[model samples]
Target chain A: MSAISIQQIVKTFPGKHSVVALDHVDLLVESGELFGIIGPDGAGKTTLFRIIATLLLADEGTATLRGMDVVRDYKKIRKVIGYMPGKFSLYQDLTVEENIQFFATLFLTSLEENYDLIKDIYVQLEPFKDRKAGKLSGGMKQKLALCCALIHRPDVLLLDEPTTGVDPVSRKEFWEMLGRLKTSGMTIVVSTPYMDEAVLCDRIALMQTGKILQTDTPQGIIDSYALQLLAIGGDHLYDTLQLLRHFEGTANCFAFGDKLHLSLKDNSYSAASVTAYLEKNGRTDTTVEPIQPGIEDCFMAYL
Target chain B: MRVLLFLLVKEFQQIFRNPAIIRIIFIMPAVQLLVLPLAADYEVKNVYITVVDNDHSSYSHALVNKLVASDYFVLTGYADSYAQAMLDIEQDRSDLIIEIPGQFERTLVREDKATVSIAANAVNGAKGGIGASYAASLIQDFNTDIRTDWLQLPRYNPYPVIAITGSNWYNLHMRYDLFMVPGILVILLTMVGSFLASINIVYEKEVGTIEQINVSPIRKYQFILGKLIPFWIIGFVVLTIGLVISRVAYGIIPEGSFGLIYLFAAVYLLAFLGIGLLLSTYADTQQQAMFISFFLMMIFILMGGLYTSIDSMPEWAQVIAHLNPVTYFIEVMRMVVMKGSTFADIRSQFFIISGMAVFFNVWAVLNYRKRN
Candidate 1:
């Protein structure tokens, strides 16, 4: 059985005009699996996580964690789930040690009882354990928040965009920590807007406008993009792109870094033929190469 | 219950670790309780006066002697004219002036009653009134003495049949501090618990820390309770310190049970914590929270009878005071401390505070939205 099963969940907020934050969203997380929700800002990632965490009730549909209904068994689910929110939500006035100990105590446990589970991250905060949580550096505060979330030895961990504002090094370190936690047979569901981080997850769901567009393994999604893609570059790249759009059999072309990534209806067109055509149209120093579709490419294809 | 205990401990740690908060929580109360009361008294003393004795007779000298004999007034300067006395009044060097007419003793002998003019500055109305009354009484006493000596009759004491037996309960001297200390402690506790609690939580929301706690398994109630319990305890500790200072500095002790006072304080603290929670739900920034709480606190304290008697206010205001938890707490505290009332004596106030606590908690929990 899946550790978490969300079936056609829907939530709407009442206002002058109703805001449809979640619409018929469904997800399933297997035990001991690392799942990721990939989307940009306002994509309902946090809303979905909150509903599953039992922090909010879905306006429609059923969500269950380990066979316990989110709404009916909220108190029971609270004990088994560890959630780290998108923002740093620890008590600012409390010290680092105080924050962790408070969370542990809330769960009817002590820090010593679950020290082994969080010791790796908690140890780094030992020097500044007495400092107010508000005064800690961003990275230290992040670590402390994660430690507090994990201090209760929860079964399912829900991290809502945990690395949104941290430095790259801290971001990388945080993922590594998640990986270590995953090996301990804990189910992890994380959300992020960074496509690069999508590759680190065992599986990912691409979401947009409160709807899940696709859910699959990162490689599976990329492998499923059947169109031939080519990276094209030349002088007057803008002019080249305009000319390429008018070319026969051209499907789609958009700027990708320093090169233009193009999808074509036919693969029979030769690179020399494209270069000759660009040169004929007053372009120079053009280069073209065939490239494999990445997760970003797959995301663009869906968009 | 375990969660509450953990949260309380965490709060104590936060309050105790910071030296600034420690100073505010512990030392500030002592200063307010000890020093502010002594400075706040309205009892008048050490009055200064300038005498323009036009007669310069033994009779005028005798009247001046009577005035100087009283501790209330001291002869500061001898003014040559009314203009000089006006200078003394403007400079605050003297509060009163006595102008004795020429031939004062001869006029009194012929007219039976001679007019002695007295001018006083009435800027501080209460003080001015007291000083004027003292001067009038002194002159009247002298006139009566002269009448008695001239007539060769025993002194006629008016109101001889009337007797006043004065007794000050709880506070024998009615030290202003005794009346003020408990009220000050109540205000401090409300400021620390409600004002600070709301600011702490709302600050997290403003800084985006609330999002972190929201995603955690920590329930919303747990988070709020965790934030409030520490402040509540700190407020109580501050109250205890204030109480000790009142005892040491003002020699005022509770006439009622100390345990009962603390019990009422705990209920009042919970109501205050609920108010803080409700404020957190409404505010998004610390400054906004502080200002809003400060405004509401002002209203609560004004109607709470911290400075004035609520009974003296309009009936509508008295009804509003019934809804104010601070009002009941202050009333209950004063009764226990000053009147030495037992539990049964304050049951009505206890019921009102208990009802308010329940109402505030429900309101706080209901108004607190998890998703926004």
Candidate 2:
């Protein structure tokens, strides 16, 4: 059975300034597959997540979790899905253990029943089980929320922007935990604005303005770039980018770190040819190389 | 049911964890019941009056003496002219000025009628109105006294006067505290019950923990019941503490069945807590719930006949008081405490509040959408 499937779900918020939050959005995640919804803020990623979690009703379509309709069979859907909202939503006044137990009881399960699933995370939080969740640092709060979300032994987990605001160390640990969870065969659908994290997903759908721009494996998306690209670095990186955008042969020129990812109008322009052109324009110190596209390169190409 | 029990446990843990809230739960009812009744007096007294006796006649003096004699009015001064009376009023020594017209006694003997003008400071309308009515009743008594004293006319028997012979059955002393304590207790219960339900849930909503709960498979009614049961139980604990304090400090005991009061109180709290839950369901923030509950509590207390008699209010206000749940609770309390009224005597109140309980709880639960 497919772990999650959404069919042309449309949702619009009615207000003084009516916003079409979701517009004919659709997706299907295979069982046990780790899928990522990559988008910036207000890209309707959260809206789609909430609908799939059965917390919100779609205005115009249907979603199903493991064959249970999100609208018609929402109760069963709720039992089978673990949803961690975009916001840190654990009770701040509650102790860490209490929050876990509460969420466990909500699913008619117990911590002992699902310890194996959350052992790695809960073990780190054990010393502070007596401490209130609010007093925990950002990383600890994230871990507690994750534990609570997983305590029910859910068949699927929906994590919306779980690592949006965390230190680099914590972000790495969070993905590692996700990697372990993925291996356990529980379907995971997580969203993040970080394009670098997109490569970690088995497959990702790039979303913007309530639309999925593309859905593919990271390498597949990178390999599908049709234009020949060159990475160019020079003595003056900013000046090179300015000249490259207006260059007659330049199709796309954007700064990627210390260099520029430049796609040329002509596939015949080699690194030597571009270097010779920049050299004539007083950018004498330049290094140019043909390079493969990263997920960011593909994302900027689509944008 | 297990989910409900867990939710209830969570609510209690959160409430008990806050020492200040727990302190208030136990202490507030006791303090309010003990302190509020002493100052919440409805019977007006000590209305200061300045009499301008321009007639200077025996009848005018008799009227002045009558005003002085009634405990309701204090004779602040006697002036020969209206200007002096106005001066007395300006000085704030008197709230009212009684101007007996010239030849006040001759007119009564010859024409058989006399007019006395009463002017009162109406800035504080409620106080001023009560004072004026008290003075009017005193003067009416004096007129009757004169007819019996010196007129020598055979008492008219066109309609026999029926003295009310009002027996203030249970509270024979008519202590304001006895009447007000029970009403004040109901007010406190409503405020605590509604505020607890509204603010507690709204706090969760504001902090977004409610979102976590909303996404769960919990039934809507179960969620509402769990939220309400904690505060509902606390409300009754307060009622029990309030009753004990009322008995010990004020010597009040219910003449009616204790079981009936408890039953009515349970239903009253159910209805009130439902109102609180409904408010919170519509509110997305703690501040909004608090202000809305506060506004409703104010209306309930002021119109529920806690410190004011519903009968004395205008017709429209009386109809509104009839609809207010707090008013029914206060009335039932008075009937049970003061009149020893049985449940049979207050079946309407019981049915009305039970209906309210069902209506409000259903409304609250329906409005609380798990799939928001």
How well is each residue in B9-95 modelled by candidate 1, as lDDT tens digits? 766665566688778887788777777777767667777889998888988999999999998899998888888898999998888
What is the fnat of candidate 2? Answer: 0.90
The CAPRI quality class of candidate 1 comes to acceptable
Q: Write the per-residue lDDT of candidate 2 for residues A231-287, one digit (tens) a residue.
A: 987678998888878777887889988889998777777777788889888888888
Tell me each candidate's TM-score: 0.79, 0.89
In candidate 1, the residue pairs with backbone N, CA or C atoms under 3 Å apart (3 or more residues apart, or in different chains) clash, namely: A88-B209, A89-B209, A89-B213
Model 2 regions more than 4 Å off? A232-240, A270-289, B51-70, B74-80, B100-117, B133-167, B311-318
Query: What C-alpha lDDT values do all the predictions have?
Result: 0.84, 0.88
For model 2, the local distance difference test gives 0.88
